[model samples]
Target: MPRATDAPPTATPADAGPAGGDHLGHGLRTRHLTMMGLGSAIGAGLFLGSGVGIATAGPAVLVSYAIAGVLVVLVMRMLAEMASALPASGSFSVYAERALGRWAGFTLGWVYWFTLIMVLGAEITGVARIVTGWLPGVPQWGVALVVVAVFAAANLAGVRKFGELEFWFALVKVAAIVVFLVLGVLLVLGLLPGTDPVGTTNLLGQGGFAPEGVGGVAAGLLVVVFAFGGIEIVTIAAAEARDPQRAVGRATRTILWRILLFYVGSVAIIVLVLPWDAPVLQEGPFVAVLDVAGLPGAARLMEAVVVIALLSAFNANVYATSRMVYSLAGRGDGPAVLRRVSRRDVPWVAVLVSVAFGVVAVGLNWALPDTLLGILLNAVGAALLVVWVLVAVAQLRLRPRLEAEARARGEELPLRMWGYPWLTWATLAALAGLVVLMLADGTARGQLLATAGLVAVVVGIYGVTALVRRRRAAA
Candidate 1:
């Protein structure tokens, strides 16, 4: 890979934007962060998994989305409140370390790192399979490698270039989703030419809206929570923005609304367009609506759209995982070697190591792509719940200090979490309830157990490593 020829960056305070030599370029703008969040939310899951939610909960899936979307909004607000005050590249990891302790930071950071790597593999595997489906002759792992390599190279480019790549990649899917919503709305209202209106029958007729009962909604809730996993990338990107405080504040406010619209709005349209039990529901609700609405090339177009969504996610997650590892390394939680940045101020070494996860992902896709992959993805996703729980805790602990510091300096806080401790505690309770619900579901039970096991391993690693280093120092 090509390297940056620029001189090493100077050391700056850890609280400020990336430390000189250790920093990512502050080239990101508000639009970049906003779109990145949007791109992260509208991934292959929405493109495909929404159909499953519909199938499982029937029209009551709308309620599932509403419940999940509200939780995401509250979680983001809590995160943004802290992030705006303490803009560090490490985001929540730094917050945990500050409010909790090194043990807390190490646990959350590595668990999040592992989750990102596992997801990267899923992304590569999904895209590779898509390619093999189209070409018919190419091997799956081979194509997966090519996709990972291409994005790795793109990520290796300077930060501004990575932003541009993500911006456009995300734009394609955003446009597709918007067009989908418009067409769906028109079809539902009988406003489109030569089309009978898709009335409320599909939503009302299917054993009533909550056809599967509250248990079904509970099942769908677990899936909904996982779908919102990648949206946290916005906060990760926040520390690299030119105006970290302002950019993060603005993006946090708008990103949630946009994500809700894309998820809730689009899913509602699909359910209204076709009954939950439609024979073709398994294919994807988005495609079903397009086909029924007499759209040209619906199947082929959706395939292309899905490919774009996965590739976009692949690119963004590569950027995310690299930065995350870079954060861990910077804190001396991992290899010091990963702390170095390139001439362009890119975390090149970290990029390669993160891409190594993609390599792991490819191998997984080649081997036990079924049960094992499902279990791993679910377990890793559940970690996001832990990260969120800690974020709220961190703010409850840190926000008072942040406010006091601002007062001594005689400056007003730029962003705030609504209702302070009250809302924050409520969000924490909601997260806890969601976890219990997740554990209760038969399908999701395995994943929750896997998460508990993974958490134990992470804590164990931290404890043993800390003990060894302390003894070595004493010796």
Candidate 2:
């Protein structure tokens, strides 16, 4: 394998922008890569947003998760192909640049960076709200401030330290969900204390399982699509992994099943243990299930879990946000200062900037209590979908070229994306459908606009850079 710096320079684009040719530090391990994947994929959304999906689709929400899960599986396969072929800190953004063109990469990279930063802000805000509930006199902003500082320090320590911290954080959430799943199965079997098996009747009895119909399922897909947003963090983390290609293969192969069990299994338990129409489902579905299961301390337990979820997301998002910025700078996509790495091999400058952005977002939320995090988060959500589409497009263009390269070198390509152009096309159509679905939802529509606006800003910057380069070349 060629060192990034040793790899031959790409044929310059007609308007050749700066090439991201630096070698990323090899600081991450196999374990870190695997756990980062878990940390990124499992978040508060599963614990919280599934409630929204259930409210919209009822029992049919399970189908929604299943459908979305299949789509993510396909996307991961595409991601794995590129990550294995060319492991880079920039992940799919680099693939987009190398495979498609410079502007495509630059746009997706910046868009993803913006999305993660806003998401980090939302995580801080979310954790603060939960913390305030436990400690009333403390202002929510104070808690959010403290949460961001602590996680930022942890991230600045180094990639290995960040991974170890995330491993335990991911472990707790994973264990709790597993316990919930076990208990749910028991309760459904009439084995749990003080409860009769609700039987399978609830699955079909209430609104015939598809009460809201296929459109309900389609609407549910909107929420489910957002749920998979964090999975791509695996690819970003892979660049530093001990053996990136293998780590990606392992994580990509296993992620879908874990998500299905954790999400679909947990939701299934919630529905079986309590009525799908239960009032608590409108608030927090997990709490609703635990309350009915006769847990003596369900609220306390859930509050603790939600706080952990928020903090875990906070830690992972900060790391992800900073790395994206560092990659951008390393690749000449942003300010040069962001490319500096500390003695610990951590990109501290990028880390501080990302944390500062999070702190500012927290302050805005505090000043405008009526305003929701959605305003800041909308562009991010839209950017996530766009990045995935870009990955699909990148693979569609690059895979054949890569295969040809491997054949010429007398090396068989290992681990290809499952289907060729057709499966790739199907995935794109699915993404297109999701974007349309998001547009139909009034709340999500604003996010689409903001995302479009953000992309436009990046494109404008690209145009300016191209013109400047052309003028200098002519001179």
Candidate 3:
């Protein structure tokens, strides 16, 4: 009943290959893929940070979001093109190795992994903020600890359960955004109870919409970049999808529209419905908008939604962080223990290690008080954008070889990145500029330092490992 070719390949310690163990189970489906994409894209950024961006850029923040949205779409397209070509558990890390070199893979994988763990810290801190608002008596440290334990346990349950949980978590977020958007649209059209038709005057009325001028827009771009950090998780999750290529392709194609509608659409409505100078934006934009509508139970509703949003982020980060570790282990870049999979087809060691690190972040949030979690948040954004640049470069390097291979095999590539070499280069250049900008600004310098320090550490480890291997070989 079995063919020799059907047997799974065995892995060895010296081989940078995925270990044999129930195959990590391709348990994700199209629905899971879709919701995961939505879940990754929608986060606390929209609810919390949009107000900051709007304040910085005035009405031009809409333009800033649009610009950032395009960049994310392009990056996702580049990642999808690569993922479709060789769908693997290692995701962009594998793409970098195959396209560039072992160094590229080692560096980018750790950087991405670092970003995820740092976000794990930030997510717990964020949840604590919302929680403290509800129960003023509770300490931030205790709340963060409770949130981490709950979400990490959710992640250890296995991919299917994680996907199912995120599906509902994503649904709650999507529903909130949709309801907000509908209310915004209705309010603008003078359709809501006791509300008049708001004209476009709000767009230009608040000090001509560019009160802070071009400099403000540039400053606002930092936060705009952060808003897009989580969008790349879809690529990581795609490797586990039933039809990885199709899922990635479908998700990429539709993701642009979703970002436009949920992010751009919602912000546009907020600017139109309320004055740009509203004090509520200082507190919280999403909360402010609902309170403005004078809806009964709006504050409680928003607090609940924000809590769900934070939990969803924690869940996703743990999943992303563990998968990153599992991938690094599979490729010989991390601890061998991380490569071990459990009966549930989950990477148990990797998950626990990631959770342990998350717990540390929680502890830091409580004890340190004057920590770099806030700075690392910005650094994580820069690092993620840097990862995007690496993915784009990797694709540029590998596309020709991939095309040649397909042509030799008499098969055409079904999905190809549009405008190939030049567009890819432009994306890289744009990311480089962002990094340089971050370096030049006093506020953004911390992000550059964190990202550079992390990169250096990974590179050092890689070099040290290589030296050890060379000495052993000579021995």
- For each candidate, what is the lDDT? 0.82, 0.78, 0.78
Worst 10 residues of 1 by lDDT: 1-10
Residues 181-246, candidate 3: write the lDDT tens digits.
999888888888888888988898978877778777777787677686676777777777777767
Using TM-score as the yardstick, the better of models 2 and 3 is 2
Worst 10 residues of 2 by lDDT: 11-20
Question: Which stretches in model 2 have alpha-carbon errors above 4 Å?
Answer: 2-23
Candidate 3 error regions (>4 Å)? 1-22, 369-381
> What is the C-alpha lDDT profile of model 1 across 251-304, one tens digit per residue?
888889988998999999988888898878788788889988988899888888
- lDDT against true structure, model 1: 0.82
Clashes of 2: 0
Which has the higher lDDT value, candidate number 1 or candidate number 2? 1
lDDT of 2 at 90: 80
| Candidates sorted on lDDT, descending | 1, 2, 3
Pull out the clashing pairs in model 1. 9-21
Model 3 lDDT, residue 24, Cα: 67
**RMSD per model, one decimal:** 4.3, 3.6, 3.5
TM-scores for the candidates: 0.94, 0.93, 0.92
Q: Give me the candidate number with maximum lDDT.
A: 1
